[model samples]
Target: MIHANRWYAAATAAEISTQPTEHVICGRPLVLYRAASSGKLVALENRCPHRQAPLSMGTVVGDDIMCIYHGWVMNGAGQCVHVPHQDSVAPSVRVDAYPAVQKWGLVWLWIGDADKVDETLIPDMPWTEDANQSSVFIRFHVGANYQLMADNLLDVSHSDFLHASTFGSHAGRKAETEHVKAELDAWSEDGAVYGLRTLRDVVLSPMAAAWAGTDKPVTRTHKTCWTPPNNINIELIMENDENKVTIHHDHLMTPENETSCHYFLIWTRDFSVHSGYPTDEDVRREQSTVIGTEDISMVEAQQRNKIQFGDPADIPGAADKIVVAVHKRIAELQNEDQGLSAT
Candidate 1:
């Protein structure tokens, strides 16, 4: 289920311009644009009240959007400002407006109660603003429940099998795949859930070794933290006798519906800012390939199976501890929203 009180990423800041962009979050169609006058970001219901045509198809005029279908103009506040061949527009004629803001290079919106709009709820990705680091932002549309995608990120054990050819190549050297699953730690605190894994003296995948500028075995520490409403940040630290490197992966998921979601990912690294083996484009391409092809492909199939079987009573493995905790945390949040005790 979708939580109303949390902020969800609607689009990247670069995606919103004078030209309207459309996105669906929490099953609500929204049109996002920047005002020509004040350059402020605005989010409105995609549908126009006059003809039910998509407002995103219209043009931005000053701090307002004019519906192209019938020349109905709506102010940034969603109030009807003007109408063709009419002196004044009806006060009751208006569309829904959602609070939108740009934070950490993303356009975030609040689709719930006006009184509950909280900017502080937006998580911080300080690496995005750091000048010394290299950061790449990528997004995709996943054909699965947002929870399924969350499950994928919370449980990294699948990396050995699903991403063997790419990021998990070195981790899958053994047949049983028990080495990578060792030292798993899961916990919940302060409205968030977390998972940590530490691998010592392990061979890095080709891509990761190239990033580290070394192919030698290294101690790798991986941690995943999940905030409410499907925001995850993964911090990876790799160290050896020569050098140490750190990378931060920030992932945000917003529900388009029960069966689909929009995934936003930002990959930031403290190393490789200047001359490096993996250029920014290289990092982007590799990350896009692993996530778009490997992770998303698996989740979509999982969604299809879930639809066919309704719900399966499969046995849970040891690596599923974090995934289970995250599921329970989400249920608790939903219960709190509904004024019911968590079961």
Candidate 2:
């Protein structure tokens, strides 16, 4: 079952202007738009209840949307406000309306009971509002289950082998090996799993060196936190005695359906903020190459394998501790949401 009570990042605020946008979250089709009159963001079921036509294909008029099929109009509250050919609007003719808000440069939609929504549960992205940090946003449509992507972030040991040329370095590999052999501390708080690790005296990869402005050995700290129903934040710090660089990553995934998802990513850093050492396009290209070419390909293949052969039984290792914990937490949340006790 979907974690209906949580907020899901649907789209970037800039993407929804005067036109209606369509998004599928938690297996539900939603249409998002800003009212032309009030400029308020609104989310409603995408389909018109009359003929089952997609509301997203219709045009916006004032604070309401007109169905293209028959010119029927529905307001932001999903109330059937006007019917072109009818004398009176029936009170029962209305679609479902979802609560939506814009924060941290993104549009967030609540998929469940509106009365139960807690604003504090919306994960924070401090970098998005920080004046000292430069941020870049990108979105990807991944052909894999959202949970697989979460697992990938929880266990980043794949970087050494999967991202050899970009993020792998001899010293980084050595540090990773040692870190995997040692115990990793992961705990759950407020329905989220957080894992933190610090690797000392590690060699920096080219990308890390460029970001840190140094090629010497340094201490690297990686912190990964996963919020239920697909939200991940990663804070990476590269520090030498004199210089320190911090990169904060936000991974927001919303399920398009059972087998696919929409991945929204934001990479914010304090390195060379005003110097433009790395252009936005340059950073976008590098990240796109790594995640698009490397991670998505691998995860999609994993999904295909799962589809071909049911869930395979595999032994967990030391490096999989965090990933396993994340799965267990998800199961707990789902069970609780459905009013069932965990066995």
Candidate that would win on lDDT: 1
lDDT (CA) per prediction:
0.85, 0.81
lDDT of 2 by residue, 1-343 (tens): 4685888888988899769888887777888899998999989999897898999999999999988999999999999999987899888999999888889989888877878988787898988889899889998899988878767877766664676667643333454553322225788887889988666776666876777778887777778899866788989888998689898989998777778888899999887777756767778999998999989999999999998989787578766777887888988987777622111
In the predicted model 1, the residue pairs found to clash are none
Give the per-residue lDDT digits (tens) of candidate 1, residues 63-146: 999999998999998998999999988889999999999999999988678899999999989899999888898988999988
Name the regions of candidate 2 deviating beyond 4 angstroms: 171-183, 339-343
RMSD of each: 2.7, 3.0
**Per-candidate clashes, comma-separated:** 0, 0
State the number of backbone clashes in model 2.
0
